[model samples]
Target: MLNYGILSTASICARYIAGVRESKNGFVYGIASRNLENAKQFAKKHNIEHYYGSYSECIEDENIDIIYIPTMNAIHYRWAKYALECHKHVIVEKPFVLLKEQAIELFELSKKNHCFLMEAQKSVFLPTTLKLKELLDTKIIGDIKYINLSAGFPGRFPEGHWMTDHASGGGALYGSCTYTVEFLSFLFDEPSYQYDAHFIKGKGSADDVVHFTLLFNDIIVSSVISMCCALKNEAIFYGTKGYIVVKNFWKSNGLDVHIDGNMTHFDFPYTSEFVYENNHIQECIEKGLTESPVMNKEKTIYAVKIVEDLYKQM
Candidate 1:
C-alpha cells in the first residue's frame, strides 16, 4: 500500500481524503494542519489514526510515504519542495506552482531524490475525461475551433482571502482555470499553443476574475474564469462537427455531447474522481515510473507555460 498523509486541513482535503479512504491501494495514515484542533477533528472524522499539529510533523513521520498537498494556491511550491527534500513522494493539488521555474525545480528535486511526483489535475485522470479524449481522438468533435470554459464562486472564502490577492497567486487561472487549461492541453498535445490573459483586481489578495484565450496552432480557444460576483460554472468544447458541454469541470460529474444539434449525455463513474487519481499515483509508483503518462512532465511544463503567460498579461 502507498501510505499517505494530507499536508493541510483545507477544504480540498475533504475530496482527497474521501478518495484515498475509498481506494484499495491507498491509506490516509495521517493528517496535519496549523491548528491542532482542526487536525484532530479531521483525523477523528475520517477515522484516521495519526494527527500532527504542524505540516513539518507529518513530513517527518516515517509512516507516510506520500504527502498529498491540498493547501492554499500560494503554498504549493513551498510544501511540495519540503516534502521532496524530506525524501517523500508528493502528489500536489492542481496548478502545481505559480511559475514554470518552480515546477521545473520540484521535478528536478524529485529526480535527484529518487522520489515520485505528480500534479493533481483531475480531468486528465477521471474516467469521464479519458472517454472524452478518446472521442476527440476519433474525430468525434471533428477539428476543434473554439472552446469556452467559465467557473466562479461568490465569496467562497473570507473577505480578505488570498484568492483576492494578485501577489498571493490569486486569480481564476491559478485557482480554477487550471482545469480548463488541463483539458485543452490534454486534447491538443500541449504544444503549438499560444496564450493571452487579463485579470480584474478586487480588494482581496488576488484578481477577482481572469479571462484568457488560447491558440492551438490555427484553432482559437477562449475561457472566462470569474470569482468576484455570484457563483456560476460551465465548460464546453466547440469543433467543426459538434461540441461537448460539461456542467462543472471541477466536480467533473457529467457531460453532454452535441453534434448537429443532437444531444448525447455521459455521466462520470460513480467512483470518486480523486480515487482514480490516487489509484493512478500508486500504479505509477509500482511501475517505477516518475510521472503519470496522461499528465507527464512535458505536459506539466506546457500547463505551467499557460499560467506563466497569463500572469504576464495581468
Candidate 2:
C-alpha cells in the first residue's frame, strides 16, 4: 500500500484522510502538527499510526511514500520543497503556493527528485465537472456565451486566525477566488483571458469580498466570492443552444442540463468527493506519472498567474 504522511493537523486533512483510508492502495500512516498534542489528538481521532510534532519529522520518515501538505498558504512552498528533497511525492492543498515562481521551482524540484507532485484540486476531478467537460466538448451546450460562478461562506473565525491574517496567506482571494478562477480556466482550456477584481476587507489585510470578471475567447465569466457572506456555491453556463448548472459545484456528484427548454439531471455514484481525487493520485503514482492529467502543471501555473494578476489589479 502507498503510505501517506500528512504534514499538518489542519482541518482540511480530515476529508482527505478519510478518503485515503478507504482507498485500496493507500492509507494515512503518519500525521504531524506544530504542537505534539495536536498531532497526537488528530492521529488518535483518525486512527493514524504515527504522529510527529514537526513537519520535518513527518517528511523524514523513510516509510512514507507520499506527503500531504495542508498547511497555511505562505508556507506551502517551503514544506513541499522539503518533501521533494526527501524524495517523497507530495499533494498540496489548493492555492498551491503564494506565487507562480514558487510553483515553477517546486515542479523543477519534483523533476530533479523524480517524485510526483500535484495540486489537490478536487473540483476538477468531480464527476459533474468531468461530465461538464464532455458536454462542452461535444457541443451539447452549443456555443458557450457566458459563465457565472460564486463560492463563499460566512465563518466565525477570531481575530488572529490564519484566514484573517495577510502574512498567513488569509483572504477570500486566496481561499475562495482560487476556486472560481480555476473553474473558468479549466472550462476554457486555459484560453487567453482578461481578469479584474474588486475587494472588501474584513479582518486581516486580505480581502474578504471579491468580485471578478474574466473575458475569454467568446465568453465572459463573472465571479463573486466572499467570506463576509454566504453564496449559492453554484456554477452556471449559458450557450447558444442550451445551458448547464451545477449546484454545490465544488463537491457535486450531479449536474442539471438544459437543452431546448428541456432539463435533464445526471448523477455519479461515489463515497466521498475526495475519493475520486485520491484514486487519481494512486493511479498516477502506480503508473509512474509525475503529474495529474486532469490538474497538470501547466494548468496549475496558469491558475496561479490569474491569482497573481488579480492581486496586482487590487
Candidate 3:
C-alpha cells in the first residue's frame, strides 16, 4: 500500500484523510505541521501513525511513499518541489501554484526525480464530472454553444487569514475560479481557446469577485466566482439542443441533462468525493507512471497560465 503523508492540519486535511481511508491502495501514514503539538494532535485525531514537527522531516521519512501538500496556495510550489527532490511522489491541492512558470518547474523536477506529481483536483476525477464529459463527447446535448459556471458563497475568514490576502494567493480566483478553469480543461481535454477577465476587490482585501469569459473555438464560456456573495453554485452547459445542469459542480455527485423538454437525472452517491482521485493516484503508482494521464502536466500548465493571465489583467 502507498503510505501517504499529509502536510497540513487545515480542515480539508480531515476530509482528505477520510477519502484516503476509502481508497483501495493507500492510507494516511503521517501528518506534519510547523508546530509539533499540532502535528501530534492531528495525527491522534485522525489515527495517523506518524507525526512530524517540520515538513522537511516528514518528506525525509523513508517510510512515506507519497506526500500530499494541502498547504496554502502560495507555498504549494515550495513544498511540492521539496518533496519531489526527496524522491517522493507528490499530490498538491488545486490552484497548483501561483505562476505558470512554477507549474512548469515542478513538473520538470518531478520528471528529473522520476517521481509522480499531480495537482489534486478532485472535481475532475468525480463520477458526475466523468459522466458529464461522456455526455459532451457523445453529443447527448448536441453541440455545446455556450457554458456558464457560477461558484461562490459568503465565506468569512478570520482577520489576517490567507484566504483574504492577495500575496498569500488569497481571493476568489485562486480559491474558486481554479476549480472552473481546471474543470473545463478536464471536460474539453484542452484549455480555453482564449479568455478575458474582470475582478472586484474590497477595501484592503484581495479580489473578492471575478467574472471571466473564455472562448473555445465556436463555444463561449462564462464564469463568475466570488468569496463575498452567494451564487447558484452550479455549471450549465447550453447546447444547440438543450442544456445540462451540474449542481455543486466542484464536488458534484449528480447532474441533470435536459433535452427535448425531457429531463434526466443521474446520481453517483459516494462517502467521500476525494476517493476517486486517491484511487487514481495509487493506480498510477502501481503502473510505474510518473504523471496522471488525465490530470497531466500540460493541462495543469494550461490551467495555471489561464489564471496567471487573468491575474496579470488585475
Best by TM-score: 3
In Å, residue 180's CA in model 3 sits off its true spot by 1.1
- Residues 1-314, candidate 1: write the lDDT tens digits: 88998988777888888888788689889999999999999889878899999999999899899999877768889999999999999998877888899999999999898889989977777777777778878978888777777887776766677766667766667887678777777866775667788788767657777788877667777778777665458777788999988777756777889998899998775667788778888888888776788888777776777787777766
User: Candidate 1: where is the Cα deviation over 4 Å?
Assistant: 230-232
TM-score-superior candidate, 1 or 2: 2
Whole-model lDDT values for every prediction: 0.81, 0.86, 0.91
Local error of candidate 1 at 281, Å? 0.3
Best-to-worst ranking by TM-score:
3, 2, 1
lDDT of 2 by residue, 41-145 (tens): 999998888999999999999999999999998999999999999999999998899899999999999988889999988888888888998998998988999
Candidate 3, 102-139: lDDT as tens digits:
99999999988889999999999999999999999999
Using lDDT as the measure, what is the rank order of every candidate, best first? 3, 2, 1
Best by lDDT: 3
Clashes of each: 8, 0, 0
Clash tally for model 2: 0
